[model samples]
Target: MKSKPSGTLSARHIVFFVIAAAAPLGFAVGSIPLAIGRGGIGTAAMFLVAGGFLALFAVGYVAMTRFVPNAGALFSYISAGLGRPLGIGVAFVAALAYALVSAGAVGPFSVFAEQMTQSLFGVTVPWPVWAIGGVVVMGILGQLNVELNMRVLGFFMIAEVTVLGVLGLAVTFQGGATGLSLAALSPSTIAQGQIGVVLLFVFAAFAGFEATALFREEAKHPVRTLRRATFGSIAVIALLQSFVAWSIVQAFGATVVDVANATPTEMFAIAARNYVGDWFANLITILVVCSWFASISAFHNATTRYLHALARDRVLPAVFARRSQRTNAPWVASLTHAIFTLVLIILCIVAGLDPYLDLFVLGSVPVAVSIPAMECLTAIAIISFFLKDRRGLSAWVTYVAPAISALALAVVVYLVLANMEFYTAQTGAINWILPGINLVVLGLGVSRALWMKYRSPRLYEGIGRYGLE
Candidate 1:
């Protein structure tokens, strides 16, 4: 067996990786318009609210590093606090969420890539071809050193941020169409929209930060790096997203809500073209593709790591835990993830689903369900862990903070459930059906854990035994 790679990732590497998973440009081009339409001027405030909740969650999350250190992320934390049975259940939930979202990106990536290819070089290729091409590229990258993937993501991350930053600054300096007002941040403006739906979008935007702890085993200084990366990623994403949203509001002035409602999908690109130039808008379009690629790579890394962690703990086939002798990458797990996503893409094509609408929307539903569920679980795990075993930690760090975070996440979950129709924009059975599928997945996970406990008690005992590596 090849030795596992260790101490190869810095805080910066982890930070960029998490941000890439969040896919700032993709959100800006895709989801932000929807957020603006629904939340109106209060979009920025919702982001801050989401950020605060995550920050509080991070307080206990990072503190867990002092005791539980494993790449299983919420799995390990839950097992430590809750128990191995529940931990195993969450492992499946996390895998399903990450895998669905990762695979979901291929659709958008292919759609945009095909469009850009035809527009730029006049070469007309089918969307599936571009998607398969991305699968090939991502698979190859997945088998390389973790640092190599980090560098690739870093470059793409910088490009995505730079383009948006330029557009944001341009709008800021020009004083927008509204001439710089704080109305967007006003209480009345925030109250005007459906805060529940807006909060769901806000929470979804911050989904990737939890991946920070997933890199614990590879981080140079696991404790410090995890803490810094988690907090930093949340802070940066919140501020950047809020600032960009505000810039758009300023650009559209009094008509911002109307424009967002009318052109939720094209608002950002239109804003870029209007404020910057056609050239910048073109650049933004290009970066949107790169943004998807970066996100795919980031999500690939995360999903593979989760598989590796499970396999390492004997929950999955040990072959998945195998590392490449040369690069020390989780080659088996990466390949498995790649093949899985490729299959999903093929299925979508066969079904004749719209990549942007059907694929992305349905794909995101699992993620929306899984992430908040995990957050709420993790927060409860934190409180439960500290309550049972203080381990010399402060009450605020372990109890108060996590309790507040849990309450916030509970609200998020309620909001998501209450507004599923608005959230998915799908009527009829699909909305309930998609979320129901998640529950079935969770049920299977829990059932598997209970079976393991009864039939293979010893194996179940090792569910979340961190520090094994």
Candidate 2:
């Protein structure tokens, strides 16, 4: 028996997972204002430009879905095209990237959870209580069947998007601070003020899009479903980000940049109040908290599956491959990942780290760095895979598109590395140390793969091939 497919998932379900990971309302209220500050009035176009650039990467990515085994996307794709060693190496890096995202998210999730509670019921509970309690709930949820998890993610995703969409529409209908303007989308604004920085912030919003590929066995019509989910997530994220960004410009009208620069954090809260109502603003604030939790859940599910993929392939421990016969969820791996997440948050708390600056900012650095680096490698892998066997696919999908995407991603990798301190808002050993962790992890993975190649050749052959022995 192949023991394949607990096949109730679809492209729409995967789309829910991906968007939940991106956390549209959270990004809109939190990051977009800062993006506006750096990128200036042209922030709207920057979101679309980043999306278009990723679409180039997606062209080759989706094309190869038919060839690469769906055993955790990044590792399997790189391994199939490049080699088992690099694939194992990527598998480790992929795990590191996704696992750390929760590290960054949990701190803020706690803070907002506390805020939402106190706002609603005049109860000032401490953040640490919420922090540990939050992970506890997700840990239990992680062990359940994924459909249950996806439904929770879906409800939050819809609620946040609806709130943001209503705000945008309200701005359109009532006219904004200076009477809705086209200044945000003006073609002339494209080349203006630090466009590179705009691309940096916007691209980061699109980081978790690959969670879709990990669901292949569970997907109805795996290939087509993967393709649609892959492309569809990109389009929805880009449009939602761009539309709301442009609306913010309209909402504030004339002094948008001045206000964004002056008060980036509170700008969205203010917009929600003026355009809609104070109650709507409160709802948006509550949704921001939900948004961060949704992202944590989405990434938790992604990393658990990533761990299970590696375990079944013998890249890690066989113990992790244990699953629920009834729900088919990877129960053991899910618990393992949940435990890992809890320890990281607890460690940060014990060290007396500031959850916002030290925990959230520094914790997020690896995800911001490693994900782009992996994308570059995967794009290059696609080019290599196609060069050998075109398999009747067009040159564009096979090679041309990925080549351009790889080159573009190479620059993105450099830009992210160069600006680490600026965004992390830290100076000193912390900069190199953060990225250094990712490099060391990647190197260790490569070293392990080399050792496995000679010592355990059969298992090595199965790495990232869905345990093909």
Tens-digit per-residue lDDT, 1-469, candidate 1: 1123359788899999988988899888887788888777899777877888899999999998767778889989998888877887888889888888888888888898888778677999999898889989999999999899999999998998888789889998999996998777776766888898788787877877998988888888888888899999999899889888888888899998899889886888788888989888778878899999889889999999999998987788889999999999999999999999888888888999888777787778878877988889999999998897688888999999999999888988888888888877778988778877777777777888888789888888887775754
| lDDT by residue (tens digit), candidate 2, 1-469 | 1234447888899999999999888878778998888878788987787788788999989877777746589888888888877877778888988888875788888887788889888999888887788788888888888899989999999998898889999999998777877777775786886766776688878989977889887887777888899999999999898889999999888788889999987898899889888999888878998999899888888888888988887778889988989878888888887888788778887988877777777888887888988999999999888897798889999888999989988998898888777778888988889888877888888888899899999988767766333
Clash number for candidate 1: 0
Q: Which residue pairs show collisions in model 2? A: none
Candidate 2 residues lying further than 4 Å off, grouped into runs, are 1-6, 467-469
CA displacement after TM-score superposition, residue 118 of candidate 1 (Å):
3.4
Residue 61 accuracy (lDDT) in model 2:
90
Best by lDDT: 1
Error of 2 at 442 (Å): 0.7
lDDT of 1 at 148: 92
